[model samples]
Target: MSDNLQEDQQQAVLCDMCTEEDRKPARKTCMKCEISMCVHHLQAHVTTPVLLQTHPLTEPMASGAAGTTKCPQHGKLLEYYCLDDLTCVCVSCAIEDQHRLHNMKTFSTAHKELMEKLNAEQQALAKDENVSLEKWENGEREKLGSSSVRLIEAVSKLRDIALTSVQTSVSARMVSIKTSKSSMQVAQNEKDTFRFLQMFSQVHQDFEKAKAVDLRKGLEPGSDRDKLVQELRQGGEEMVAQAVQLWGSLLILVDPENHQEVFTTSSDLTFDPQSLGIGMSLSKDHRKVFYNSWLGQLSAHTLRIRSVHSTSNFQRWMVSLSEDCDWTIGLCDKESAENLKDGHVYGLRCQGNQLSSLTTDYYDFTDASRNLEDSSFGLQKVEIPKTEKKRRVSSQLIKCPGESGGDITPRPQKVEVFRNIAASSLSFFSRTGQHQRTEILTMKMSFDSSDFFAFVNLEKEQAQKSSNQPPGPQQQWMCSCGKVYIETGSGYSYGGCYYSKSPQAICSCGRVIGGRVIGDPCITEVVCELL
Candidate 1:
């Protein structure tokens, strides 16, 4: 009895592992279902382990609708497949109007066919994805290669632009340097002229002093005085000749790169006797006076000359024209109290190709002569005539020879001494057709021009007197109206645009006007007589 009870207990435990089914034999154990069952009762078992535990059935038919197909579109069991329309259909669907044209087949056959087609479509989609991925990778590589090349080209172009900028800058600097070189040459020439003029004046002064000493001593013929006189004469001539040469003009010299000369006039233009005439006439005041040959042509005009004893001899002259002749006169000399009443001196003039004289008072030779006479007399006879002095001005810095700092050569001081002398001398009375004995002199006149003094061969003598008197060392050169120094060359300075090696850039206006450094600046005279 105990053995029967143990066998019954083992049978009960084994029965606990049966599958659920309504009506079928559970002959096999379903490993995934976790069930064990007798084949004879398995057909009615429920499908899941939970259902099997509760119902305790043993049947293959327990899995409801096993091997049955479902329709995705209708959510219904696929009872049949329509071969003509290529669709699954239930028995009810086939009888309906929607499936009327569909040919029916078992659900098992339709399921197998649908599964094969779905697998083929998935495989095709995977292949297409791989091809698209390859194309995308190639495009990325091409884009990267193009970008690298563009970057390199951009860098090279930038480098070239930088180099071009540097070259342009260098060129501009070189041009500036060249311009500076040209201006320096002009300043140098002016300074040299100043130095020469100073030297010329000293030489003339020495000659005059020597002559004065000989005259005062009144030497005997056989004595050393006679020999000294001869020596002094020769020395004086030599010194005067040197002084005359100082008046010779200069030229503007150009560099070898530009071999051009600087001046326009080349005829050695000097005071020509052909252009002037002197004659004496008795004035209404019973004074013997002088008039220019040309002055007589101005409607029967007559000019008078008069002399006054001063430190230097003071001379006065005046012109009177017929009331019919509408000729105007101007003085070319500087204006001063003494010159104002003396006379209206005429400046050099040209009309209808005939050279004449202009009347102006700017170069009032009468005043200039008065000043020179007073200055020469050492303030004894006449208080030194107050003269208008030129203010000294300087040029920009230039590299001068033997200079420590850059040289600032001053523009030459203008002295109207020669003009004054001319005014006074010309005022001397002279008789018509009388052979006038005169001394030829070399006078230094300061002129404001690109050239220095005009080397004019002027006759110095008393216009009326032929009496033998020692010529005064301080003689005057004058005009009937006034005296004027010749102004030649353009007023602008050549080679004055340059600056020197200095920290400050000098302004262009700082340059001084000067004579030409390389050419003649005056007209030549064929014949001239001296007083």
Candidate 2:
């Protein structure tokens, strides 16, 4: 604004062709010519036949360093860069045999374009890094906040207990001292020096008794400290659990809120209301299949079909279950539900951790010599191999995860079954309390749907919950080794106990429960995982 024009004019370069007496400021600089020219000389240079059709021109820099950088390839000032070869090329070298076919661009133009690209990528990287750092910091902050709250509560509780202990001790001591004082006063009032002198030892004994009360007993609870230690060490302890463990290792991420609120997520679960079995109702935005008291009920064995076949419309679907939840949970097609009274249908049934279903190969039911199991309606069981004791299986079926294909083991906890209907496969997996997915079973695609691919089976009604239900009058604890550990003549039966005389307990559900037999009431409770 203050006339830098005069300064520019004063520093203007003289035309190389102009005379000193009538010098003219340069208007253009030819990069090939490596010189400047005034307007008149520039026009003459452009018109001259000796010059090429066009000459490259650029503005002068304040430092006068423009057009001074040399190219390593041809040893001339670098005017262009060959992007194809990733090399610098001078004006003279650009037409040479080595770079004639190369894709060359002016250095300034190429540099400008590349700089913009680099800046954009750098900005994106910075944004990503900031987001990750913020998340990590937030997690640390939450942990610190929770820990501070717990510590403050624990300390305050201990402080109150210590204060109360000392206060009680002091009060008791004061009462003893008062009694001694009264006795001393009596002695003095009677004017007896001998009795008062002897009273000192008695008073000393009373003081010792006051000191005997423990200052650290209940006030310093060792259990509280032990709890903190145990929490810190919990991750390192060896844990025994039942689930579909991976072949080697896996990383599981969980959001407890996400799991608890699964019923509300409509996008993940697909339910067809029309295909529901009688007495079953949809809940939690149609993500859950639950019993409906208002609806007329059907037999528990009735199969619930999905309106849409997974093989055609949906490629995959998964059903999640909780521990102690009752559901057959499987993959079946249109034919699976039809003609089942004919003693067969194609489907995969997961009961507890075990995967059991009639396959292409089935039992020969005609064997009279061998013991045979009674077939249930719409279900055929290969006669269970006879153990030493032929214990009767419960009418209610419990399935477990991670059990062998033929095992009758019960899975009594949270698990999910994934069906890839088209691929003709079903996967059984389980989730621990920690919400980690362990794969339970992956069978070869056998339930190829002739029609239906997406199907589910559920009980008509949930068994009513009985509070504090004691062991039946005839409960007995049976071992996996087929011997009764605690025999009861009452003839009532519970799930077998978990532990045996052997080193390891082998069963599908991981543990067995026998209430009165092992003298453990805890056995009556279906345990999921140790929290």
Candidate 3:
């Protein structure tokens, strides 16, 4: 039984570093160094200069079948890649870090996407090579071909000139040699060797003798190598320039050094909870804002996304909107969501198809529809949303058992009032599509990192019985105490509707619901809770 139990137990190798200090077990082996270390020594191996230089950190072989790869931070498996951050992260890191707000994809998916784009670039380069080469040949070939002909002619002429000079000098030298060596005893000189070899020997011997007598006096000075280099530089410049242009169009090279033209990942956008209204909660890295119940409590606050200002920051992001989304996405300053008018909408100020100010707002909001009337944000013919009933729970007093016990009854509930503040300049877009995924609006913002950005959202008359409000319509509300009542038609009337005297609703029980979303909603101080 003891032998069987021993056989059933698992075994492991001890860490080499730990064993050096004591008889400790090794957690994992460093593939680079072929040494094992305990968990403690594993960490030191990465931090200690001597150990780090000789060893690298890896997962313990005994841990599981997950392989010997672990995140440096949590010692967890790095299974996901953050597309927005461009990094590999553990499950914990993905849920807590800015990566939580970022776009994440599986490693396999990311690899596929990258390979696809790279393949696209390869295809583009192939096309460029064919088209550009053909066009360049057609345009410059006839002309350059003539130059080539001229070049060949010039080379041939130079070679001919050289051969002529060599021949004339050799003939002259031979004559001089005969005259100088006439006294030598070479009776059988005609039978010295083959005709060609004899001629070469005679010419060399004559040249040597002439040098001693200072026969040849002058030769031109030049460099064939230098001339070739100069010609190559002049002709290659144009071809190099065309290659650079084609590379820019087809290849997306990511590097900080190329920031002037490269598009890098933008920082994650999150909302400050302090900027959110009552009853709304932020979830999934502040990407979604949810109202707990259908019971509407009036609050004049717009949702905002955090702003990125650094020149290195350039990002384009899309927001998914449900078919029932009445919310708007926009850019604005801090005070925009704080200052609310009673009945006037506070978010965007949309006019026609064109937005109010491209300079002021990053963009103007518009819908993808054939007719303006069928859409909720038609500038002129604004149609109200259809009605839906919601259940409201009322608080009733409980009667304790007594001689004069009476049945408990509930009283009429007072309406709640919420107000929105006037922003310096607010911009927004209406939501559309199923799961809010289909009708995604992409916004591109490029700016210096030093500036502040505040994104805000406002759902117009959300709790109101009718959906007949304009793009950013607000409902009027008077407090139950009648102490605080905002002006009906005096909201920040920049791009929203500008009107007078509209119907007003009673405020619900005046309760000070905390301002802000549950998670980070973008606050310039901060910003992304959208209601």
lDDT of every predicted structure (CA atoms): 0.35, 0.49, 0.43
For lDDT, candidate 1 versus 2, the one ahead is 2
Query: In model 1, how large is the Cα lDDT of residue 180?
Result: 46
Candidate 1 lDDT, 121-230, residue by residue in tens: 88887887898778866775575555545545555554454445445545544554444444344444556777656655544554454334322223434555465556
Worst 10 residues of 2 by lDDT: 240-249
Better of 1 and 2 by TM-score: 2
Best by TM-score: 2
Candidate 3 Cα misplacement greater than 4 A, ranges = 1-267, 294-298, 307-313, 322-326, 340-454, 462-531
Candidate 2 lDDT tens digits, 64-95: 54446556555676668888887777877788
Model 2 stretches with alpha carbons more than 4 Å out:
1-26, 38-40, 45-53, 61-70, 84-87, 91-103, 107-205, 213-531
lDDT of 3 by residue, 410-493 (tens): 111110111112222222222231111111122233322123344444443445524552342232222223222223444312
* 2 against 3, candidate with superior TM-score: 2
Models 1 onward score TM values of 0.20, 0.33, 0.22
Off by over 4 Å in 1: 1-77, 81-89, 102-106, 151-159, 162-531
RMSD of each: 48.8, 20.1, 33.3
Task: Point to the candidate with the largest lDDT.
Answer: 2
